[model samples]
Target: MATHRLTELPADALKMIATIAGPVHDVEMVSAGYNSEIAARLHLDNGTVFVKGLRQDHPRVWTQQREADINAFTQGLAPALRWEIRKGGWDLLGFEDLGGRHADYSPGSPDLELVLQAMRYLTSATPPSGVELKTMPQRMIAHVTDPADVRFFEGSTLLHTDWKPDNVLIVDGQARLVDWAWASSGAAWIDPALWVIWLIASGHSAADAESLAALHPAWDITPVRHIDAFACAQQRLWESIARADRPDEWTHKLHAATQAWVEHRG
Candidate 1:
């Protein structure tokens, strides 16, 4: 698909949607992930649909397929994936829209519980074998693995490592989480800790995020050490991926957590 500015995409995209999905009443460009060129929620006379378009940026194809696969079994908790169309240069995806509310990260339990529930679902979903961790814990240790971490597979579960509020939709008291570009199958505890770290980086306080982490059954002492290491690795990964001008926030929280974890190891 040809890449265009959010406001400049060819009208054909919307025309095709209206033709198939029934006159699109409104099209709201929503999100763009790592290699994503388009992610939007389109409201139609019949209903609402979440649409994502990918161009030559091949990353979009991989993510579009992954998210659709995962959401197949995540009924209600994830937007219903409706259709996938691959035209010449574009990969398009349509999903049932989840309305009600977008995720907000202010200090509070309502939103916190919403995100945690999504993390819990991803970390617990059944997946393929030999999937102890996404990558060797050793390799990701400095960049993604947490401290005192061991990558041994007791189970294989698909994990939505990027389960933040921004990716979640809360509709009429129910919650639905979206975005699967970073989805992976790994240890039971890594995803929860990772999501918590991301929330903290986005501005949630350590005490607040820790409080939320505490709510997760995966936060037991046996895993906190590795989880903390996992958090630090995630921080470094975020910093590495952040724009040079962006202020790195997770680096500080990760440092503090690492130092504390190390002290306890002594």
Candidate 2:
């Protein structure tokens, strides 16, 4: 079973958002990202939107503004925004929740087509001018990876910094990429690289994930190579947060398994 911890927004903050959103029931915070909060379905009676608080320290927060701004200015591209409030460290972003189901993509599964279709559209669309990766390379590398090979991926006009099944949902056989916090100026390969890694982490066999990554010819390096380099970035992070001291037989074994896989690849 997957364990997900959620945080409830403060009372004052709740009312502050209700002022603009109208009626709301409750909200839950995700464990992965500090400032991201998802309001439940019941809370969205007439209409409700996903709310994300910005953090100055977070590299992707600024790109979120770019996403909102892009969606506001363009048509039929990104999730539509209702309003943006200038809060202290980060702004409050409220966007209409587009109805979608948690995407289930795996090796040899057609669900991947949904992700690919969306990838094609996003890479095809033009992003706003004067945009670059706001996240520091070192820190970004720390979270996922910063292989020397990744330098070849720079110079993309518009790219989603992060992409994974959890960050995407399917609606009417099409994929909608959410969680724009990682939007950046890198090449298109960066987004798909992130998605391939998620596939491997979520129980898909390594060979299968590698095949999926290779399907995208636009990417400079093969998905398998990039996945190997970046795999430690996320696995090490989980161990750090859980404060794992050693490898166990079952749960902490995840770290052990990751290590084994890394060694096998090397």
Candidate 3:
């Protein structure tokens, strides 16, 4: 998973980007996520645009197309997709430049409020017609200890299940979500449930994380059984991921937080 600086892209790829975004005067690589081989802010004479892409033959190349397809239906929470192109063995996407800092999920941080606001808005959204997204039950079927546990995740709410703090940006006092690669259609409560794990990873106690999750309207009225089931299912899911990937320190921290939530629920 080596990263490619803007300059390293082949002439054909640069030509394709220039065709849509005008000449690139400068390129600043975004060092955040690892999925992209090329991710950076391209500074043009007129303005800046964020570009991300990967090798066309990569197994996860479809995620590039998926992000573009879902961006149109994400309302304003995600940056608008400007264009997508295939060039020089790469699939690339350009997005509106949102010059913002990654969200801070630590307890008592004001960014927490903004992130919750974005989550609440997202929970109310219905996935646009003809978008074939996997339902939560289908997604969790492999992770849940009991197949019946997956039933709690079944619903039509468009859930952004990846709650990594870096995926959220606090721009102009509003929270904007990025990296829609894992977006799924699921129960409204699922997002908050996922956020609780992140909150814990950011140093909030399990009780405080649950308290923060309470800010979401959907979480307030969810059945206790469903909550418990989801907590158990997510713990199992993260545990499997941790075991399989042997992720880095931060991911292991989040997995530990998920385990704490499961114990708290028990």
TM-score top scorer: 3
Taking the tens digit of each residue's C-alpha lDDT, what string does model 2 give over 23-105? 77756454443225333332655755777664444544565566566664334545677777655454567776777776786
Candidate 1 residues lying further than 4 Å off, grouped into runs, are 1-5, 31-35, 128-155, 243-266
What order do you get sorting by lDDT, best first? 3, 1, 2
Model 1 score (lDDT): 0.61
List where candidate 3 sits over 4 angstroms from the true fold: 1-12
lDDT of 1 at 260: 43
- Candidate 3 lDDT by residue in tens digits, 31-136: 7875677888889988999999988998788778878889988968999998888877889999999989999998889999999899888977887677767788
What's the C-alpha lDDT at position 124 in model 2? 68
What TM-score against the true fold does each predicted structure earn? 0.76, 0.69, 0.94
By TM-score, the candidates rank as 3, 1, 2
Which candidate number maximizes lDDT?
3
lDDT of model 3 at residue 217?
93
**Which window of ten consecutive residues has the lowest lDDT sum in model 2?**
33-42
Better of 1 and 2 by lDDT: 1
